[model samples]
Target: MAENMTGDIISDHRERMLNLKKYYPFFRLIDTSFSNFKDGKYEILDMGYIVMAVLRFFIEENNFKEKDVTYPEYLDFLRLILKRDFGLDLNEQDSKEIADYIFDKIKNDGRPFEFSYFDPVDRKKRVSRMKIIESSIRDNTVWYSISPDAIEFYLDTKEIKDESRISVSQLLLEKMINSQNFRGGVEVVERINEEVNRLKLKKNEVLTILSGDVFAGIEAYEEFVKTGMKWFDDEEKLFKKNRDLIAKSIEKLNASGSTGEGYYRTMNEIYSLETQLKQAMNRHSELLKDCTEMQKMTDDAVRRAKLGRLRSHMDFTSALSDMIKRDNADILVTMLSPLLKPNIRKTFDLISIDDALMVKPPRYEEKELISNERPEDIEFEDEIEEKRIKDNYVFLMKNLIVCLKKSDIITLGQFADAMKRAYGEQILRNADFFSFFVNLCQKDEYQLGGDAGEDTFLDAYLGEGFKDTESFTFAIRKGLGGQVILSDNCMMADVELVRKEAHGE
Candidate 1:
């Protein structure tokens, strides 16, 4: 019974392997290399070298365009590669023999093991891309070319060179533009989504790594800042261009009155692009905002860590406690000499002042002890406190708006820095005021308030921060250290006030 069970297990395993091989045929070509197997082992070798040779031939000789090679040409090329790269001398061997050997080796190849994957689209166990060989004949001359599937495998495994990556975003945009065709539109959307997901994952990874450790090298921090800023700038420009294209497309679609299928298709494509563009733009904004927040958090963490270290080194609390325990009060007094009053020489005797001792009982008026007493004329303390906070918020908001108006754009960090510098720490260090400023920046209306009338909405007419001191309120705007520029929609307008308008001066 045990033998039967073992046999059944083996048989099931064999069946699964067969299924995997059936679904993915490219596995057969993988084990073609003579070096992949050891001596006396019943195993197929790796044949990836042959694929590499084929690719090299096309790339080095520019034969990809030709797409075909004669029987003799193929043999000569393989013979030359073996001689040059593998140090094999096939000169004495017949060309026909070499060709037959290569063909037999390629056709009879098997993989090291069965590889399979679950296909979501087909909802079944599926194989990856396969079929690594393509050959044909015409008029007694055999021709050779890598099959499309083989080409795809090559591309998938190859590394993309830096030059090829110079305009990756541009290429994606082009692909999205051309994906209006029925066959590829879905794929294009999937690709875009995949890229966006990758970016989000990368951002998360960066934040996680940064959060885990605070004392990164200066060079690492510098590089991150530089690269991050550049990335934002470049992506922002690309998004703007995409927005313009979508806007124009929408306009064109609206103007055209044709009810043809082509028209409808184009319209559908335009809508799709619009949606994609919006998502991309939003993701871009999210990444920048997240980066900004992460930077602030990292800075705070590092500062705190440094401060903690400093306190550890400079701590004198234990010493003071020890002094008190030992009754070393005299030493403590000397140590605190700077804070103690200085001793002075006696200038007069206590008896000399006896004649000047006339002390009139201080004239006292009837006064009320006002502890815990309700006063009808005064506002409640809680109400007063709430009013103060509200007033501070209003003041911060007006200043922020004025700062934004003075410049076309500014980042939240820049605004914060400006607030600290111009107004001093009196307002920026206030938690409530800072929160109010951040809230204003997040408003949809304020974001779109870069336009003419919108930009001036937060002017002096609405708040006292813009009150004229001289000829105009010197609107203090913050600059963003030349790294990130605020989006036009989020920028506030700096407003100037004239005294004549308020009191009819």
Candidate 2:
């Protein structure tokens, strides 16, 4: 009965292997209990069939109708099956070999097993049935199991031909090259080239791998390209808008009619003041010349008197008379009584009589000097000083008008320099004149007063103030240095003043 029970178990194992093949064409039963029993040995079940059954269930469930599975997923499926069905913890290497055998059978034959089922009843009735089932299962199963080294061989060969890695690598390379980050793109292409070369892959195989990713890269590249195009369009629009605004501002400036006459008036005023200043300077030079000439005459007269004294013991009467006439005898006599010689009077009287005789009567050569007007020959020092001061004030007014016409901002330092340039050292001494200049320049009628006094405005407009008195002094000392000439509109009133000054009206 024990022998019979053993035979029954073996027959059942054979039937089970056949059924497993029909359901899972990708997996094959290698060795079963029946085959082992035929060799007169009974081994305890390892339940490898349970692993296969669960894997078959998974494949059917996921609708994986493929004839063959690749290495990685196949190995993973085997491990999953083992864990699910038998709770057997198989290591990675063991699971991989089992999966490899299954893959090989499916790849080669399109099916895992040669025999479909075993007839246990027929084995009892006909010995041939037992032999047939055992032979078919053993040959197919043991063929895979005998050389387990074949699994590794198959995997090494199959992995080389797997195009998935190559496909993904190619996709990555294409994406990187089209990316905006140019450096990163170059790096990715280099890495792809190195890897492809290292793998010893054929050009066609590499190209095929790369093809799949091309479309994906193109999609992303299109989006990036559009973004850049839009940015350029936006910039162009902004530029046009700004250009139009500037054009409008220029048109407005042209439409206003205040500029031309204003500019002319301001320029004329400046020129008139300049003329007056020149005249004052010339007068001062003339006075200096006269003083020098008078000093020379005095020296000559003294020398003549000394020479005459040596020539004549008669008290040098001719030299004394000449000296008194040259020195304004009447004033000298009153101012320097102690220095006057007693003989100087007698000599002066004789010289006076000779002067009266030599002086021709005025023929009234159309008296150049009018009775009410001062003579050109007579110079009044006080009047010259007053004219100089007036010229300086007029010059400052002219500058202020020009600056206002131009819509130019004049800083405090610039204003001060203008004053100094117009009036020289006199401006520094006259606080009232400085105050008047500031008040006049800042008037709305002059159009010189804007928001220029505000600290924020000044900081933005004027770069920085003079660092020291030397810079300020240097700025004011020259012809153009202190001038803050403005536009035509601002200088109109000043220009009118200049015209009046020119005609002396």
Could you say which candidate leads in TM-score?
A: 1
Runs with alpha carbons beyond 4 Å of true place in candidate 2: 1-48, 51-55, 61-69, 101-505
Tens-digit lDDT track for model 2 on 1-505?
A: 9999887777676655543433332223343332344252223224345433533433332222312333354467667766775465767765565555444443332221333445565553211100101111231122112111122122223332333333333333222222222233333334333433333223223223334454443443344334322233333333244234334433544576557885555444334433432332343344334434533544555566557668836445765787787975564465477766465544354435534653648777575654886646644443464455545554554564454334344454555556577667455445334434344434232212233333332222221221121211001112223333332211111211112222333
lDDT of 1 at 381: 40
Clash totals in order: 13, 14
Residue-level error in angstroms, candidate 1, position 199: 3.6
Per-residue lDDT of 157 in model 2: 32
lDDT for model 1, please: 0.50
Write one digit per residue (lDDT tens) for candidate 1, span 1-505.
Answer: 9999876665465455443443244445554555433342312222456546755564333222435655566677877766676665654554346455555554433112235755433457743323344455455344655443333344345442322221233333533443333223333444444555455455555656666665653334555555444456655665676567567666766787788997877778777666766766676676678668767876787788778776646347887788789977676666688778766755785434422442336888899776886656755444575566657765665665576456635455566668778877555445565445444443233221122123442332223432333232222233323432223213233222222223333
Residue 294 deviation, candidate 2, in Å?
99
Error of 1 at 75 (Å): 12
Task: Tell me the whole-model lDDT of each prediction, alpha carbons only.
Answer: 0.50, 0.38
Clashes of 1: 13
